[model samples]
Target: MAFSKLELFHSLILVLSVVSVQALTWTTTPFNPPAIPLAVRSPYLSAWLAQGAGAALNDVWPTFWTGSVVGWAGFVKVDGKAYSFLGAPNVPGAAFTKATQKSSQFTSTQSIFVLSAGPIDLTITFISPVEPTDLVKQSTPFAYMAVSAASTDGSPHSVQVYSDISAEWVSGDNSLTANWSTTTGNVLTHQVQLATQAVFTENNDHIQYGSAFYSTTNTVGATYQTGADVTVRAQFINNGRLPNTQDTNFRAVSNNWPVFGLAHDLGSVTSSTAPVVFSVGHLRDPAIKYIVAGGATQARSSYFWSQFSSPAALITSFLGDYANALSRARAFDSKVNIDASKISADYASVVALSIRQAMGATEITISKNSDGSFNKNDIIMFMKEISSDGNVNTVDVIFPAWPVLLYTNPALGKYLLEGLFRYQATGQYPNKWSVHDLGSSYPNALGHNDGRDEAMPVEESGNMIIMALSYAQKTGDNSHLTQYSALLDQWTQFLIEDSLIPANQISTDYFAGSLANQTNLAIKGIIGIKAMSQIAQRLGDTSKSANYSSIAASYVSQWQTLAASSSGKHVTLSYGNSASWGLTYNLYADKLLKLNLFPASVYEMQTAWYKTVAQPFGIPLDTRHTYTKSDWEIWTAGIVTDTATRDLFISSVKKWASDGLSTQPFGDWYETTNGQPEGFRARPVVGGHLALLVL
Candidate 1:
């Protein structure tokens, strides 16, 4: 049938409309998480969209993980009519029609949103590349926001896209005066920073000493402006482009609300138009302050500093590597989805949501050379024990978070442990057992020289030994074990003495308070002894290995009698409390390391017991409370022999995640019955959710 060009265009528009209606349906699976990850790369670069009922991107502002607003806004002009797609709510002179969000979905490394603005459909993707094997890219601390617009009505239209970030991203305290400037080279950058830099300090979990960069490629039709938020956005709204001017009025962030804006003009847009990409990052030179082996505090820079000459070069490289970065991220997301879905779709969704939150808590750093360069070989990764306590490189925290690192890249686990090993090897810590954490406060890796760190003797020592061996087992690298042999032996000795009958102490679930003869704590110590046996065998100390093996065997035989309930149904929370049961997640290490320390009957018994006592969300941490830790639940699920039992545990947690009980980040601690967050949110412990895949 021959038709006129106008008739053909109308027919194509009808077909596209039908397809768009089907594609626009939201697929928020497992369910819509309480908060969606936005630009979550490192701890300081982290941002999230707090989810509310029917929450669209245009209406709600993105916030830091600490719940402080990080003023980022996006707008688009189609045929000279402005529409809001991301943040800015009320501009005095510019009244923008809010775009209708069509659909949203999150994967392991990206959050994607589709919105309709007039005749165009905009696809916004937030990509925080998780390059585990590529330290240079992974340590860059930059996240990408790529926006693409296409004609939804099968007709061409003039389009211009605008995005801006306020000075509030530089300092948490809005009253602090901010300074900003624009630079043009390979990339156009708007750098905003606090006037007064306070190194190694944080205002409400926001790094107070870094410059925040909002940058884009220096392509044709790209323009930039920095000024009062209203003035800058109003100009873009009125003219469909920025003025390419920088405001010299440096003032408090809250005074005039300064914003750095960039705009791109696409003269005519169709379905085949390319995406415009923007990069946002925070950079702090000498990112951490650490006490060295000789008890002298030294400044450490992020590993990216070793690769690039300056922050500008680093950002330029990151901007240039967008295509490769997105490819790698998509590959990673696909692998996570395929592997996790083999268990259940619910498991896949939970695992997808947890990757960024887990990796976001860590920073890889290196020592600065005397010549002002960086020494890359002296590298260590530090993690903030976030939300619960701001401790640095906490042993127990890493123990739970280690599974994800092991599943992704074993080398990361080694980097996390290196700082702790260096601190203890220097004899700075006086504790007979392993130190609890590198420092009580974050960004300051000061050793607990006073020996006043929280006492989790059996817990921390066991966690250290198990994690060290787990890293070696996964990577077939034992140099770390050989180098730290003395400290390992010392911790093994402490475990041998106190493992069987643990004294009154706290486990990682310290909020539940201390208890004597904790069955779970004792089993972890027993497993640590067995793990040390393997470590000794790998190091060629067969005599020590045999002796440790014999001791571990004897302890397990006695542990079976002392820890089991009289009904033989499950292990008790403590040695003699028959009526009190808990998730014996420590058993996962035995399975993970291929150590047959416990019999198959023990696994079956515990799996069956979990089914009987399961809560609406999942199993509780213990009989003492109705609250559960998601990390431990997944660890327990990973070790269960029954497929249905494992799925039950996975599906239950998925139910809680979709329940919208808390709008904070993916929390590890929550009440099992109602799925309410129990204080802890956005902690790296959710990395333990990767347990099923790790096995």
Candidate 2:
């Protein structure tokens, strides 16, 4: 719709009135992501900032991670002139140009957005209660959505801002019947619960079947819902008039939008200063909590409410450490940015934006034992990148995901391995030599998804051995490896025997169909054996280490001979096939493990040959197809130390990240000829983008 002249005129006046130095403190960047992460807190309770051509905050929506609408809208009343500042909603005379939205900074634990609203400024912060060392907080589902306001006009203005949450948060749709209750604590609270209390009814990324609470906190006013939307109204009046206050803060069930909102009744502000924080949270029931957190849900739930408001406090203690948080996050971002800047700006943006999603993709939880003590049994699973399979804890997914965790904290790296180790210890997987695709589909993470046809048999065993050795090298502790030492020995021996020259088994790139004597698969097994030898050395088994080391060295020499043909510039996709070539990306593992098993000629030949096969989006997964996995391309790019070649691969990823046709977060698989998403959006394998950091 065209903007009316008077509406545009009023918007100009409002912007001109804003004179505070604190307005728009965040720096702007050239690349704007499809969505900015907001409450990137946990598995079920995460949100993102939406942007449009107008670039106004009001016109944008706060969508769930899956790009579903959470039914949230925000409005502010300035001296009785109501205006929409958040979410897309129709209001008479409120059609001002959207405010500029910016994310000043972000980390795995926190993200901040500032909106330059017409006459006032609003700061929105999303923080997970993560302390790096505290697994409990990292696993906790409670997140803080804190909003504060200040007068940018340098004149007193009565500002009341509120956000209405949609009922879809309860059952992935607003059509579900909802009952609302009003709780009058120190802060005004509206809580929505589904009349039907079914939980975990389905296992998928879409929030289609679970029930949860949708609440907005703050203000005192009548809370009710119209047939169209669940609504909560908090009015801030000027010049001695106040909005009507309801008698009993507690009320009965009514079908509304299942909405809750907070009222920031700022009487008036003349100078530029940070106002009090008004916040809200999304809480779920206790059954699923016990499954993941166990016995600790009661305390965590109580803490979630206490964080909203207290004497002289309106935000979580996390907000109190804002300065420290920003400083640390900036430092972390700067280090990544420094190297990222080494590449072209296009590639730099992809790395910066993609890394955050990688960090947020895994769902973690700490469990309490039967003895009433807490154990950091974090069951970290990377969601299959929009594969629609909803495969949980896939071995190949974990392989690409470990680089990012290893960079941040090796403990988190171990977190991924412990789950697999636990599964093997149960003997739940019948295969004595290999494992299944996933423990189970997402959310139904009970045991291996035994029903699906198996892929990545030899692929998974090799991945686990390398993972255990890589983690041990970083942390210098292999006790976890020792617990599953029998499994490791069995797997490594399998690689030694059949995996070297084996039957056509499904590999990581199973989508391309099974290839016989796949050269890349050989690279994986070679590294796996080398890693086991390294582990043996660390475990003080010098004789075992020496024997395995000699075997791996002999295999490496044979690999060079078997993989190459007796012709000019040989580039074969598999051993002796001579049809096409795939990347020996796994060869980087030699240097990563500090083992000089491979010759320099190996990397030089592959890196030089990769250029001949480059396509628009990236080099294909192999020469067999035009579709590509972005993560493997990055690993292949790591084959050389040259800056220019690495940027070539990363620039392709930049195109993939901003592809208009794709959804939120990112996709690992895409068409190489053009930047269209093929599959795998919002998966943890994007963590492989951080591969360069470890190198």
Candidate 3:
């Protein structure tokens, strides 16, 4: 059916109406909303400063000391009552530094550091004190360089500072410089790149990555107070890399630099015993080192803001502009596989709707082919980074959206397919299925390294194959499928043979502990096989297509025989007779990841089960946990044809999105009920946030 502007506008209104009503409303102390930087759109854009893991929005405080350090925590204020809690932990000084390092179970860690302090003491700060602006920003004094390395000249060979921002690098006694760049509209980018540096060192010059939040009570004239409800937590980089344990050697002096004109000589002391000193030395070897942080750095933010922010804003600035751009995009090549109307809506809706989630994440570029023919292919999505220098290719991170791109822009869909297919085609893996991820988050695509327990190979392969076919179907083009035939065949072969799928193995949903009889895994396998057959048939390979088609049809029979439930819902866990199969089973069965195998009645039953499992924020993935997968909930919503059911799922997504603006940026996953973002922001999974448009 040809979609008219009226029809498109109607869908837009429906999405906006449901979202505006169901989403949580956090009024600034004076009932005004926070000042959201118009540029960013991601999971974090929703609720600006609420740090609770659940959706209970509370006030936070940014504790800036007059000395060389700052801290943040949660604060609650009632008419006659007052409360304070450590809302988030950025750099926690232990007993080794705090009380007794032995008594701590630092399951979580994050940090922000100052790489090169200016002549004056440098300060960094954040806020969330329930003011007109959800998160308030400030500057705090630069403090302790927790980890450092020295050189022969007593310069900073390398150093690691634990402050509001993180930095690791090797510096000589030479002049330390800062890099500052900016663009209008992106407030997040404005703060990140202001007074930032771009020195590439292994340890000392690297920026530390963590979450920074604070609170405030707004006064009448756009002024706010340093309130009690602020908090800051440092996020540690757990990229599976081996940890280092070396004593720090900080830079002690600079003979020629003016900043050292009258510098005090505190001497070469290891502990924080010195009053103050100028330290300079390479922290570690300058050759082939990674001064890693938890997030994006200045340069990275600039690149992303230029590419994503400007274009997004142009679309939203005017309705005619949006329609014209969409028309131009479609006119660029009629052969593009997605519907123009759908893409238009997606572009419009994401900005109007999901802008907050997009802003809180990071974006980076990778070099693929030297000629740059595939420049678009090199655009990598970096989740939340400790600083602005992080990349976005991680394993379990692929869980965001299978169809988000399919609905918005087919080119993006092509980009996703190219990334996955290119990784698998690199001959990096021996198995027929693909590996978990290309590498750690926020860097280049290092070869897959999750090893055996890292990724559900079969699960990802099936997902890729199915998604490819869906893209082809939506675009009405069989070119992409035809081009990647060999890879698809290999994946299908793996499914039929090795994918008996051990009970204890990991599935794409990494957090769900290993399950023996994972019905969802079985469903994914069935759908994948069918997709492959369809792809083969479209490519005109009848015999090969029929071979897989026959297998898939037979598997369907077996699946029905094995997965049927007595209660009319899909069967729960396959093996654990004692396992409680709740909404996830049916949602997987009925909604999410359109295998196109189930009939309408079957989907109806599945949606019914989801209704039973529905929590305030969303439908639960299973009875095992109340927290839900936000993207998956939207994916599941795609299965039903009923407008009400679709609206329900869309409303749930808006609820999470509303929380996202103020929370964290475009997280891959989050807690279901309270809408707290879980792990990995700006990761690729947020692509799933676009699932509804495809429907």
The TM-score leader among the candidates is 1
Candidate with the larger TM-score of 2 and 3:
2
How do the residues 1-695 of candidate 2 rate in per-residue lDDT, one tens digit apiece?
Answer: 89743344334323422321123334535333445666555455656665311233455677766677766666666666555556776433233345555444444445566776667777766555443444544443445556677778787877665555655555554455655554454444455555665554432354333333333333344232322332233232111222323322222222333345445555675665453443344444321221122212221121222233331242334435455645565666666677766755655566666665665555554444567444434344334333435555677777887777777777777766675676566665557565654434554445543434365656888899988888988888888777888888888898898566756877877778987787778878878888888888888888988988888888888888888855635446788876678867787677677787888887777776666667756678887889998888888777765655676677667655544445455678888886677755567777787787786
Q: In candidate 1, how many clashes are counted?
A: 0
lDDT of 1 by residue, 133-154 (tens): 9887878889999999999999
- For TM-score, candidate 1 versus 3, the one ahead is 1
lDDT of each: 0.88, 0.60, 0.38
Model 2 ranges with Cα > 4 A deviation = 1-30, 50-56, 91-114, 127-131, 148-153, 180-182, 186-190, 203-256, 275-348, 371-373, 376-388, 449-453, 565-570, 659-661
Comparing 1 and 2 on lDDT, the stronger one = 1
| TM-scores for all predictions | 0.95, 0.81, 0.53
In model 1, the runs with Cα more than 4 Å from the true position are 1-26
**Candidate topping lDDT:** 1
Better of 2 and 3 by lDDT: 2
